[model samples]
Target: MKIQLLPSTFDENGTASRRQHLSCFVVDDRVAIDAGSLAMATTTAQKKQIRDVVLTHAHLDHIAGLPLFIDDLFAGLDAPVRVYCSAEVLETLERDIFNWEIYPRFSELKNKNGASVMQYQPFEAGREFTVKHLRIKSISVNHKVPTVGFIVSDAKTTIALTGDTAEMSDFWQTVNAETNLSALLIECAFPNELEELAENSHHLTPRNLQKELAKFNRKECAIYVVNIKPMYRDEVVKQIEELQIENLQILEVGQVYEW
Candidate 1:
């Protein structure tokens, strides 16, 4: 499996920065785990190939680019863009985002060919579903709003990703049970100094993240940190580096990793 955390922020020189303001992971350039930077950052090839978007939640940063993504290819779509998400997420999207007042109800619209422009594939938490060639399992996680983390596996590689969340038990339990796990992508959204804010927002700080990582049984599995707030990213990275845990690293923005 190939995974690339698409870049959402850029520097003054027009180069992509390491700071991640949104969350989107392109897997094998075919399926997107989130549509955060989908409309803005995808390559021409990616834009043409990715028709399946699997969402973790309805957070703005996670779904910001979704509407635009559909609009970009609205006229040419022969098949509907399949969006895999939980029912709660679908409700939030319909009420807040796709409510015509905010954006066109693409799910209700059709292309020139009479094909639906977008479609929702809602799945309950704990149920395993298939997106293209990948099998995905969603586990409910502790977030301020309805959210989930996913365990995605193809025929060869199996990986787990914790979409923005605080400390949680079921996610860890499910991850630990995956015998062929290749990598674990977890989130640390705040610096250790802002532990209180992190807790209140249902996000993880480096300190709490360390405690959470203790629950994982696979010592050899590669661990990558993601979703640090753009402003506090450096501090969070420093704190995580201080832990000096072997096999732990930050998932670099815009870089693809094949496992």
Candidate 2:
């Protein structure tokens, strides 16, 4: 499996600024984790192969482009695209995002042949499930909303992605326990100067994130950081550098990573 950061704040030089958020990973080139940037970031050929989406939560920044993503590929799909998430997240999507007033409910909305474009598949919080060729588990994390971080493994390569969290222990514990973790995509959203806002919003600053990482027990694998606020990016970068974590690397969107 190959993972690529899509339209994050530090997206590489060529990607457009207006439609930036998050997305695009290749699980045999078929599964997408979050659809926020997939609509605009991917080519038509790539969209046609996206058979499943494992959403972390329903926040606009995480799931905003999902509706348009479905619409763009509705007619192009051979079968329904499976959407996996917690039961609570499904309810939030129904009530807030896909409700008729906001956008056409893709679960009920159909394509040219009257088959639905999207299908909601509820997943358990700590349970493991298979999507395509990988084994995946959701680890609950502290966020403003009901959110989950994901761990995906193809046996040899175990990768953990903390969707958005602050001072999480359980997820890091699980990561440390896993024997073959190749990479970790953790988050550092605000600079230490914005510590108050980061705390209020359930996000992490460099200092707090340092403590959170301390819980990981060991720095055995490559660590890639994501989700910095655009306005305070430089400050966050400086602070993260000051932390002096040896194996850490900041994720640049549009860069393809193989592990």
Candidate 3:
């Protein structure tokens, strides 16, 4: 499996920066895990190939690019873009985002080909579903709103991703049961100094992240940290590095990682 966290911002030199202001991950360039940067950062090829978007939650940073993505491809779509998410997320999207007052409800619109422009495929938490060649299982995680982390498996690779979360136990319990898990893409969103803010926001700091990692039984599995707030990126990275965990590393933005 190949996964790349899409870059959400550019540097002064017009280069993709390491700082992540939004959240989106493209898997094998075919399926999108989130639509945060789906419209802004995808390659021409990726935009054409990725018709399936699996959402982790309905937060603005997570779903900001979704409507734009659908609108951009509205005229040419032969089939609807299939969005896989939980029913709660689906409800949020319809009530908050796709309401006519906010954005055109693509779910109710048809393309030139007379097919719906977008479709929702709601999945229950803890149930495994297939998207293209990958099998995915959504596990509810601790977040400010209703959210989930995922365990994604292709033919040869199986990996876990915590979309945006704080301290979690059920996630680790489910992940530890996966015998063939190769990697874990976890989130540490704030610096240790902001522990109170992190807790109130339901996000993780480096200090608590270490505690969460202790629940994992697989000591050898590669761990990649993600979703650090852009302004606090350096401090969070420095703090995580100070932990001196051999297998842990920060996942680079826009870099494709394969396992």
Candidate 4:
């Protein structure tokens, strides 16, 4: 499996600059785990092949680029862009973001043949679905809104992404049961000093993360941390370093990996 964690931040030189941005991951050029920075992080060529997007939640940071991305590929789509999420998330998208006042509902827009340009495929948490060569399962996580973490695999190699969450149990239980798990991409959004803020917002601090990682069954799977707020990026990294957790590192934007 090949995964590229597209930068959540913007870069003036596009791919050449290699700057980081919001949370979006391109999975083998065929699927995107999130559309936060999908529009800005991807090149035109990469965009053409991304037929499906699996959203973890309805937060603006996660679904921000969907509307524009769909619009950008409006004329070229041979088929509709499939967005997979829970029903609650779909409702949030339809009510808040895709509604005409915020943005045109591309789900209602059509191509020359009169097919909707965007279609949402809702999945219940813990249910598994197949998209291309990947087998995906959504795990509910603790967040302020209705959010989910994804466990994606090709049957042989598997990886899990804990989308924004604070303290969660079911997600870890699910990950511990994955036999072929290769890597875990979890989020740590704040520094230890902001523990109160982290808890209130349903995010993790390095301290909270340590407790979370302790739940894992083994140390074999590589753990990469994501979603550190840009301003506190250094502090969070420093705090994480202080923990000295083995097999853990802060996820770098624009980085590509194969497992």
Candidate 5:
């Protein structure tokens, strides 16, 4: 499968905001893992073809552009775009986001072609299921809100995303058990200095990341780090480099990798 990181902090060429705190990855150019920063990264036509969006959680940065994305593409899509997430995350999307107060509930709105804009595909933790050509598994993680991380595979490759988690064991254990993993895209929301806030908020600092990563017996997969807060990007990079992990790379917008 081919995965490309949309315009991120280090790779934006357009007039995108530089105070970055969001990300979106194009999986084979047909599926997106999250919709945070895709508003200016992708064109309107490409956004309409999105068939599957696997949400890590319902945090604003993670789902910021969700409403606009679905609304813009509502008329062009042949079928409703599938939004896969844990039950709790789905509830946040429905109640906090799509509720008429925030935005029209596109899940209830039918397009001119009689297609709903969004489809909720609730997923239980640890269940391995197939959707279209992808094999996906959700694993619960320690977060302030009920959240889940995902292990996605397309037969030949497995990609893991640790949405936003603190020092959590279940996710590491689940990753270690995966027999075929090609890459890991995890979030690091702060630098080591903000460890207290990071821990309380269920976000990760560089130190916590090092400690948690050591728990995984990964298969030498490419570990790409995402979600470094814009203000602390330099600090996070410096601290993370000092942690001395060999295979870690900072994920930037427009960076594409085939696995």
Candidate 6:
């Protein structure tokens, strides 16, 4: 598996930075974990190769760039883009995003191949599904909105990506149970001072993240921190460093990891 976080922010030099804004993690260039920064992070050819995308929730930061991505490829689709999500998320997307009021209902539209430009592949929580060579399962997580974290494996290596979530149990259990786990991508969005806000929004502060890690029994897998709100970036990173968690890393935008 190969994962890369796309460009979504700017640095002090006015050059594109990976510190803020929306993002998408592409695996093997064929499956995108989310489409948040798909269009901006990848090239036209890269976008065209994405045949499967599994969403964590209907939140804009996670699915914001999906509509435009589909639209851009509308005229040249070789096959329909299959979007995987929970039924709740699918409903929210259909009602709020692809409802025509916000964006065209690409799922209902077709390409020159006479096939739908996009399609929904709704999967229930806990049920495992396949996207090419990967085996994936979604675990419900404590987010303000309906959300899920994904556990992906390719037999030899397994990894988890917990999209915006607070201190939770089931997700940890799922992670610990994975024998071949190699990496974990989780969110730590606020600083210690903003614990209340983090909890209310179902996000994790570095303090909360410290407590969350206590639930895990294994330290073999690399834990990568993600989804840090731009305003709190420096503070969060400092706090995480203070925790001294072993094998922990901060995921960088445009950075790729192969396993």
State TM-scores per candidate. 0.99, 0.93, 0.99, 0.95, 0.92, 0.96
Which portions of model 4 miss their true places by more than 4 Å?
A: 10-21
lDDT of 2 by residue, 1-259 (tens): 6887665433267654422256444455677888777677765656778878898888777787678888887886667888999999999999988899899888987777877789998999889999888899999999998889999988577899998888887787788888788888888889998889999998999999888888876577888888877677778888999899979978877667888
lDDT of 2: 0.81
For candidate 6, lDDT tens digit of each residue in 124-154?
A: 9989999988999999999999899999988
Native-referenced Cα lDDT, model 1:
0.95
For residues 123-183, could you state the per-residue lDDT of candidate 4 as single tens digits? 9999999888899999999999999999999957999999999999999899998888899
lDDT of 3 by residue, 15-45 (tens): 8899998899999999999999999999999
Question: What is the total number of backbone clashes in candidate 6?
Answer: 0
Candidate 6 residues lying further than 4 Å off, grouped into runs, are: 10-16
Q: Positional deviation of 151 in candidate 3, in angstroms? A: 0.3
Q: Residues 112-226, candidate 1: write the lDDT tens digits.
A: 8999999999999999999999999999999999999999999999999999999999999999999999999999999988889998999999889889999999999999999
Model 2, runs deviating above 4 Å: 8-20, 23-28
Q: Which stretches of candidate 5 lie over 4 Å from their true place?
A: 8-19
Clashes of each: 0, 0, 0, 6, 1, 0
Error of 4 at 176 (Å): 0.8
Instruction: Spell out the clash pairs found in candidate 3.
Output: none
Relative to the true structure, how large is the alpha-carbon lDDT of every model? Answer: 0.95, 0.81, 0.95, 0.89, 0.81, 0.87
Question: Once model 4 is optimally superposed onto the true structure by TM-score, how far is the C-alpha of residue 244 displaced, in angstroms?
Answer: 0.8
Which of candidates 5 and 6 reaches a greater TM-score? Answer: 6
